[model samples]
Target: MTIAEVSKKYGLSADTLRYYERVGLIPEVKRNKSGIRDYTEEDCRWIEFIKCMRSAGLPIETLIEYVRLVQQGDETIDARKELLIEQRKQLIEKMEDMKKTIERLDYKIEIYDQAVVKKENGLKRTYD
Candidate 1:
């Protein structure tokens, strides 16, 4: 299929696909006789994985490095696995940070509610 078809399949814009290719985040695409990009099933799968990893907050440079490692073939298998594992650890840390943020917000909200209640009581006392 072409770039358009691949973009439609993955819900990504054609420009984004081109940018990914240009940035070396994605491998070079195969071109057909018309010089249009010809995307294959493997390309689609790779794009999907990229989208997932990106959504999970993986950096573009990391993805690019991972792709480079992958291109190195079997020799870099362990390195690739380690990279993924490290990324997973970072994701967990981000999740914990988010959890802490939420907890802090909750605590602040509780204090705000107490202030509101106190204000209401003070108003009642003033009226009395």
Candidate 2:
């Protein structure tokens, strides 16, 4: 597929795709004879993986390192696994922190809700 097709399919801007390639966030894309990018299935897979990792809040440097490791062949298998494990550990910690924040917000909202109910009840009593 062309870069435009890939951009539309992946919901990324064309510039972002170009930037990813330039920054080594992804491998270099093969261009057609006309000097236009023709992304392959493997390229799309890398984009998908990179998008997923980015959404999960993985650092760019971490992803770049992971990609580098992948390019280094089979010797980096254990290293790759360790990197993923560390990232997972960090993601879990962030999730836990977000959960705590959500709980706190819920509690605050419930308090406000109760106060509103109480005020409405008091007003009804006064008017009646």
Candidate 3:
């Protein structure tokens, strides 16, 4: 597929795709005779993997290291697993932090809701 097709398919900008390729986030995309990018299935897979990793808040440097290890072949399998494990741990920590923030927001909202209800009850009594 062309870069445009890939961009549309993946919901990423063409420039982002090109940037990913340039930064080694994904492997080099194959070029057609006209020197335009002709992404193969394997290329698309890499794009998907990189996009998913980025969505999970993985750092670009971490992804680049993972890709570099992937290019180095199967000898890096254990290293890749360890990298993924560490990233997963970080993601879980971030998730916990977000959960705490959400709980705090809920608590604040509940307080406001109770104040509003109390004011409404007072108004009702005054009108009655």
Candidate 4:
């Protein structure tokens, strides 16, 4: 598939995909004779993996390192697993913080809801 096709399939802009390649977030893509990118299934798999990691808030520098490790062959398998584990740990912490924030917002909203109900009840009593 072409870059545009990959971009649409992955929900990322073409420029972002190009930047990912340029920044070494992904390995180099093979170009056709006409100088257009022809993404193979393996290339698409890398793009999908990169996109998933990015959405999970993994740092670009870390991802680049992981990609470098991958290029080094089987020796870096443990390193890659460790990197993923660390990122998952961080994500869990972030999720906890977000949960607390959501709970606070819900509490504030409930307070306002109760106040509005009380005011409405008072208004109804006055009218009656």
Candidate 1 ranges with C-alpha deviation above 4 Å: 115-128
TM-score of each predicted structure versus truth: 0.85, 0.94, 0.93, 0.91
Ranking by TM-score: 2, 3, 4, 1
Per-residue lDDT value at 126 in model 2 = 21
State which candidate has the highest lDDT: 3
lDDT of 3 at 101: 100
Q: Which wins on TM-score, candidate 3 or candidate 4?
A: 3
> Residue 22's C-alpha lDDT in candidate 2?
89
Across 55-80, the per-residue lDDT of candidate 2 in tens digits comes to 99999999999989999999999999
Model 4, residue 44: C-alpha shift (Å): 0.6
lDDT of 3 by residue, 1-128 (tens): 99999999999999999999999999998899999999999999999999999998999999999999999999999999999999999999999999999999998888777777879888432211
Q: List the global CA lDDT of all models.
A: 0.89, 0.93, 0.93, 0.91
Cα deviation in Å at residue 26, candidate 2?
0.8
Query: What is the model-wide C-alpha lDDT for candidate 1?
Result: 0.89
Report the C-alpha lDDT of model 4 over 1-128, residue by residue, as the tens digit.
Answer: 99989999999999999999999998999999999999999999999999998998889999999999999999999999999899999999999999999999998888777777879888432211
Poorest 10 consecutive residues by lDDT, candidate 2: 119-128
Candidate 1 TM-score, true structure as reference: 0.85
CA deviation > 4 Å runs, candidate 4: 123-128
Question: Per-residue lDDT for 30 in model 4?
Answer: 96
